[model samples]
Target: METAFIESPLGITKIVGDEKGISEISVLSEGTVSKKIPPQLKECVSQLKEYFNGQRNQFDFKLNPQGTDFQQKVWQELLNIPFGKTISYLDLSKKIGDVKAIRAVASANGRNPLWIVVPCHRVIGTDGSLTGYAGGLWRKKWLLEHESPSQQQSLF
Candidate 1:
């Protein structure tokens, strides 16, 4: 696996993967921007840049996240969620066809390794509050706000 780091609105973002496909993309508290990205990681990095710049909505990179069959199923279902939309953990469980698996679904969502690519940040509390995020709740809020189409116009 090859790894590269890039600066993002949330902080240093780490990308790890290889020829098979991208396996992980996570946030770091501190890291220098990668000087040289591996060929396999170039497209993923580009897409991420476009995403942060609000030039892209959906990612089309080849992903190969590591997880159990059930977790993979949940992640696949997560991909069905449209961009700029949020879903509660209970809603996610029901969509995955097992309302009782709410805890398990949330656990898997928390374990999502692909970060923005997988969009686990789109999950929220049923009460409309931001919830657990591997990258921190603040980063979750940042992502949601970044994706929101309506931003306060600069009056200056």
Candidate 2:
């Protein structure tokens, strides 16, 4: 696999993949931005940049996130959530066809390897509260606010 890094609003972002398609993309603590991006990962980087810039709402690059079959299914369902939208974990579990699997679904959602691209940040508590995120709750709030179409702009 190959890797690269870029600065983002949340922090430094790491991207890892190979020719088969991007397998992993994550947000990490501040780190050195990569000087050279692998050819196989350029599109992933570009798309992520577009996403952060609010220029793009959908990702088209091929994805190859690694996970168990059940986790993959949950992640795939996460992809179905529209950009700028949020869903409760209970709702997500129901969408995945197992109302009783909320905890399991949430576990799989937490294990999603693709960060913003797979949109695990869109999942929240049934009470509409922001919940667990490997990237941190502040980053989760930032991502959701970043994607919110009706956000207010500074009066400056």
Candidate 3:
């Protein structure tokens, strides 16, 4: 798999993928930005730039995240969530047709490897609290604020 890193408002964004499809995208507290993006990752990098610029709402690139069938199902359901909307973990479990799987749904959400592309950040605690983001709660808050249509200022 080819890899590249790009600077994002929250941190250095790492992207990993190849001809099959993008398999991973994650944020780091610090890292060197790639001087050149791989040919396979060019489109994804461009779309990510548009996303961070607020010029795009939905991502249409191919995704090849590695996970179990249950996790894959949960991730697919996550794609149904709109760009500027948030859903409770309980709601997500119900949407997946298993209210009792709320904990499992939340666990899969936390393991989402595609970061902003998969939009795991849109899932929250049943109480509407921002919770359990692998990228750190602060970054999750920043992403939510960034996606808020009525947002008037940057969290920074």
Tell me the tens digit of each residue's lDDT in model 3 across 44-101: 9999999998888898888999999999999999999998899999999999999999
- Whole-structure CA lDDT of model 2: 0.93
Worst 10 residues of 1 by lDDT: 147-156
**In model 3, how many backbone clashes occur?**
0
lDDT score at residue 67, model 1, on the 0-100 scale: 99
Q: If scored against the real structure, what TM-score would every candidate get?
A: 0.95, 0.95, 0.95
Which RMSD does model 1 reach against the true structure? Answer: 1.8
Ranking by lDDT: 3, 2, 1
Lowest summed lDDT window (length 10), candidate 3? 147-156
Please give, for residues 1-156, the per-residue lDDT of candidate 2 as tens digits. Answer: 999999998889999999999999988887999999999999999989998887889999999998899999999999999999999999999999999999999899999999999999999998999999989999999999998877635555
Give the poorly placed runs of model 2, Cα more than 4 Å off.
152-156
Which scores better on TM-score, 1 or 2? 2
- Evaluated against the true structure, the overall lDDT of model 3 is 0.93
Tens-place lDDT digits, model 1, residues 1-156: 999999998899999999999999999999899899999999999999999887888998899999999899989988987788999999999999999999999999988999988889999999999988889999999988887757423455
Query: lDDT at 152 for candidate 3?
Result: 39
